[model samples]
Target: MRPGGSRLECCATDLRPRPPPPPSSSPQDPAIPSGPSLPPAPALRDLAGRLRRLPPSCGPVRLIGVDGHAGSGKSTFAGRLARALGGAPVLHLDDIASHEELFGWTGRLLAQVVEPLGRGETAHYRPYDWRTRRFGPPRALPPAPVILVEGVGAGRRALRPWLAALLWLELPAEQAWARGRDRDGEEQRAFWDGWVPAERRHFRDDPSRPHADLLVRPGHSVHEGYDVLPGPAGTAGQGPDSHRT
Candidate 1:
């Protein structure tokens, strides 16, 4: 059945909800070393390689989820990873989320994407356009060898069964929100004020990372001040032979 609903509004922890990547690390991000020491570069490369080899967690296709706080870099990482995987398909949560629905798009996702993917059929969804605050045209997602679901609750309870790997982008709430606010700027401050707390409550009720198989934090610092650090914590919490980050 097709799902239909509207998202709820929220009051902020701070109505004044004022909100990177680097070599080594930065205050916004913490360096979490894996149990066994491996060179940073090789470790990440191995992760990508292993993901490629893992038997499809969902049917014959690997349904990897890159979940984390908003502005935690899920979208950016998912895009690059898709490129690495030779143009893999990525289903962005932003498409499902609307100005009113926000995180309430799960039902729409299940009805539109997950169920179809389970049948190895194409999934269709009308992505929500934020600027105009309306859903765009229906997008068809083919059953590829791998499909990425990246967003805040990509690993939520409702979608777990369909996932081959659940990856959490390890960025704290404060730091993550700060970046989000900075990126969106003061113009959207009102929207963000409501968003931060709503996000907090959403994570509180339906947490994703605790059960994640791996946690990715990728970036590095250059001679220029822009720090780019790409580090991931490998921890596939469950699955008999699943790996840990």
Candidate 2:
């Protein structure tokens, strides 16, 4: 199942055409209010510590997933969470996805990353270069004690089975998408034009919210820290208990 192997031919055929992008519309406020105030930094740190102690779901790695809309601060949050976990490795889905195969990376991820890590070996996969529209050289990922998979669909059904915990950023789609578009700027507008719709369709078909172990919302304080609440999928009993302020 390794990359550059026979599996790739079948994987390529599994790629589906991108759906038409959704119609443009004004951004709307989230229907639900941001969850209760976040616990203090000490509590968050405690949660991270506990996660670091969890039994590895993949080989010797406790694979955590940070999933949310494109602009829902997933990368920033994952970075902070990684630091809290004492420098866990992070795998960005952006590197696995290409312009032509937005959500068609499950096979590649499994073959190049997950399977190897599951076997207690270092995983190497070619990262896609969006600017060049071609995959670059292979990147090495060590099978650390804790690893984070962050991106829009990190919690998809295909990946959940391998994750120790799935944390969903509780931001509304419209607002998140707006933030993403704004962050990328006018130059990437056309790309966003197509991305918006594809994202919408992907979520519609395989929503991740209901499967999240924790619903993470920004903190009410000036620093805008973050709050982690119990989600429909329920906590895995390894992190801090759900706290509401």
Pull out the clashing pairs in model 2. 22-197
Model 1 ranges with Cα > 4 A deviation: 1-45, 218-245
- Model 2, 1-245: lDDT tens digits are 11121100000000001122122311111221122332225555666766675567888888888888877767766766675566678787988888888888999999999999999999999987776778889999989988999888899888877887778888888878887677556766887788889989999998898977677775433254455676677623334444532
Candidate 1 residue-wise lDDT at 160: 75
Total clashing pairs in model 1: 20
Candidate 2: worst-modelled 10 consecutive residues by lDDT? 7-16
- Show where candidate 2 strays beyond 4 Å: 1-40, 219-222, 235-245
